[model samples]
Target: MASIGYFLSCEQFGPKELIDQAKRAEAAGFEKLWISDHFHPWNDEQGQSPFVWGVIGALSEATSLPVTTAVTCPTFRIHPAITAQAAATAACQLDGRFVLGVGSGEALNEHVLADPWPSVGVRLEMLEEAIDVIRLLHRGEEVSHHGTYYEVQDARIYTLPAEPVPIYVSGFGPQATRLAGRIGDGYVTTIPDADLIGVFKESGGADKPVQAGTKVCWDRDAERALDIAHRTWGNQGLPGQLAQTLPRPRDFMDAQALVPRESTARAVACGDDVDAQVAQVRAYLDAGVDEVYVSQMGDDVEGFFAAWDEDVLPALR
Candidate 1:
């Protein structure tokens, strides 16, 4: 059976709100939590971004739900060695109920350090090496390595959970999917693409969990919900590598303007129809996903949670 979880949008909410949401989600029958890690919101209209690790720290005190970074980029904005320490601490705090979801990262967060953004090929190579560095540190041994993109000198994570933290890799395409299979303890994606999961399982990821997530807006007013969805997440419909390559939130806002509201509507399930919400989540479960997470795109998070708990989740269960 597939597990269902709540996706906390750090890009759209502050730390307190996310912690509160996690507590509510656990109370509402959500089995796990996926919190996004970002330095900035997608656009100013969405308007909030908090340091994800801090929020996770607060979440550890507030709730017992298993948590994972929907994805963190240890390749650029932060060094892999440091991420290893943070993940180790988080695992200890959560009593090993933590997974580090990592990816190649986006230019919007990575370019802040003024490092020239490398091509996707280089980014992927860096991600592979970064994962290696993190795993080494997790073993609680001092590690020193000089790699093509990163260098670490005698780094070790002193605090760790009894078990090594499970690392899940996120991908949007075939190459990344293959990399996730070869290196990841699990796999994550926003889209419910069965073919991608098939490739991951076939490419040395057999028996590993396949995780997927999506967003929706639930309101009595369908048009209002649609508007909120479009405003907050229109970029979800942007095609190609635009989501990754764009260097600023404004670039995303500008590009998202061209994305038709109709497209966003189709991509995000809107309004308070419990069946619709259930169907959106069902798509991911049917796609062979072992875990499914859902995020609400607007301010009516309480309403969304209530609907899911009282109506949607029962059907899914």
Candidate 2:
């Protein structure tokens, strides 16, 4: 059976609320935690974006559950060397229960510093080099490297964990998936596509762990839940590279207008129906995922956890 975890949405809730949710999730039987790393929320409606490293530090003291960044873009917004140091410190704080999940970041976050957002191929190349830099620095040795995409001079993370942190790569498409399989300690994605999992395994990720995340709104009023889902996360329904290229929350607000409410209704599981919630997560586990993390998309955090504790989690287990 796959492990079930809670996804702490830094995009939706503030740091204190996230910490509270982390504790609630642990008490509610979640086996682990997945927290998003973002400089900005996809849209202003989502409303919050805390520095994930600081939240992770509080989480280290708040909950005993393992924590993984659902995805961080170490290539552009921050240098991979700095990311390596932050991740190392987080691992030590979490008592070795940290996973640095990285990806080719979106323009919304990466472009904030005025860097040009490159094409997918170039971004992937940068990600590959960034991963190499991170791994080299994680070795606890003074390292100086002038790579094609990055440079580091005599950098060493003094506050290292007993073991180097595991770096999981996030992939939403075939090329990234192949790269993740070839180099990642594990794979991270949102879709529960079995074919993609097969591609990962065949690309040298055989027997490695696969983690996935999904969103749901657990409410008594299904229509209200759907409304919240559509209003807050309609950007999720946008197809293609719009998510990658859109540089601002207002841009997303405009692009997400193209996404119909019906699409969010289909993409996100809504209502207090335990069966629907279980099925949503089961799809990932059925796809050979080793861990499935669920994020609540409504304001009824207490109700969501209550339902998960009483019904959804039990059924899945």
Candidate 3:
């Protein structure tokens, strides 16, 4: 059975607003919650980057639905040791309802510390080493690692969940997908590229869960909604230098400002009808995704929920 989840861009919503939304998602019967983990906002114009960990802690008390980071970069900005500790604390705080979704992050987000961005090959190696560090720490073991990318000195996590936390790797390329299969407890990706699963299996992943999502605005005024989404999130379509790596989400906004409106329109589905939004999500499921997360774009949060709650979700069930 495919579980349906709601996508929350933490950078877009304030802490209080996010908690409120999570509460509403639970009340509306959402089973899972997916939140983007970015260190920076899309641009100075968008203007928000609340710490994801703090927000998740609030969410734990705000709702019962399990939470997953849509994808977090395991390389660069934060060391695997620090991330392992944060994940452990989160798993404990969320009481087994949290999943750590990791990836080999882009240089834009990972290279902001004035450090030279590593090459893709190096990034993959870092990802491999980081995973080892994280998995070992998640096991609540006293970990001592000396690797090409990271080093941990007799580190142990005593506060993690009783069971090891589930680690899902987000991948797009063949090597990364194979790495996911070999190391990840499950796989996470934005699009349902059937080839991704094949890559995972061929690389080593077999019988792992696949989670994906599509974005749409449920608005009678389609153009207005598309305009906002493209203006705010279009950098998501860019292969490099994303909102994460950019100094601010608004930096992305400035960059996105260069793209033609049609480009943003292609990635986002905006419409007044609920069926339209649901169909967009259905297409992802049809692609063999095990979970479909719907990103509610625009300002009509109430309407978005009503449509999905009354029409889309029931039909899926």
Candidate 4:
């Protein structure tokens, strides 16, 4: 009974391309959209990183699907106040069809302001504070506060949807999952693991929606698909906090040199095998995920969509 959503990669596509994909996804029966908000692509080869807010505005005009930031970091580079305003406007524009997804964030995007990156513990603390500020602002009141990580003086969001924007928190660990349960309207993660869902629900996230996303490349030639995933996203296979600590795309490129192509092939669902793609979706469903967002990773986006719409999606339904 889980709904399927399309994940639009802002790091890989230009604003127009993303809008176009959003339209195609809607036509193809995708029910919702998850969009990444990043200042930079994981690696240079992925290229384009458009300002996510502007793209959201364009998407408002282009599609009717509900949208969520698959996620955004509101603590650094951009203040929580500004993020609140942006999310409010997006909610208004989309007619209450927008959800704000937030996380502690990676150094790659946050270090742009030249601020010293805090440790993981500090980042999580900052995330909590940022969430507090955003929720307060969404109430449409003049908010003033001085907190451990942020300060606000008479800040108010003038434009907002009738309903306050729902905020979903993203995490990859148990502590963060608990935090999401305590504060988030919903939960988000990339892995399709039921234990994470149990963690979220056990703490306080019970009855709330849980979202998960995965990447796949649909090509007839499996080897070609594997090569594309490795060249552009091999860094994704990095372990531990390497993804969070890596500061630049070049740094990722250098680190990914050590990741074997076989690793990327094993991790990502590649090739035109309909059963394989459907299996990927089933994992999320089996994990009790409320929503599954899938991203097609290579240039075959059109082909991927066509195949999924004609085959995979029907099977899932």
Ten-residue stretch with the least lDDT total in model 1: 149-158
- Model 1's lDDT to the true fold? 0.91
Model 1: number of backbone collisions: 0
lDDT of 3 by residue, 35-107 (tens): 8777776655445677888888888887888888877787788889988888888888888988899988765
Judging by lDDT, tell me the better candidate of 2 and 3.
2
Q: Largest lDDT belongs to which candidate?
A: 2
Arranged by lDDT with the best first, the candidates are 2, 4, 1, 3
Stretches of candidate 4 off by over 4 Å are none
What range of 10 consecutive residues in model 2 has the weakest lDDT sum? 259-268
State residue 121's C-alpha deviation in candidate 2, in Å: 0.9
TM-score of each: 0.99, 0.99, 0.93, 0.98
lDDT at 108, model 1: 82
Models, CA RMSD each: 0.7, 0.7, 2.0, 0.8
lDDT of 4 by residue, 108-213 (tens): 9999999899888899999999999999999999999799989899888899899989999998989889999989999999988899899999989998999998
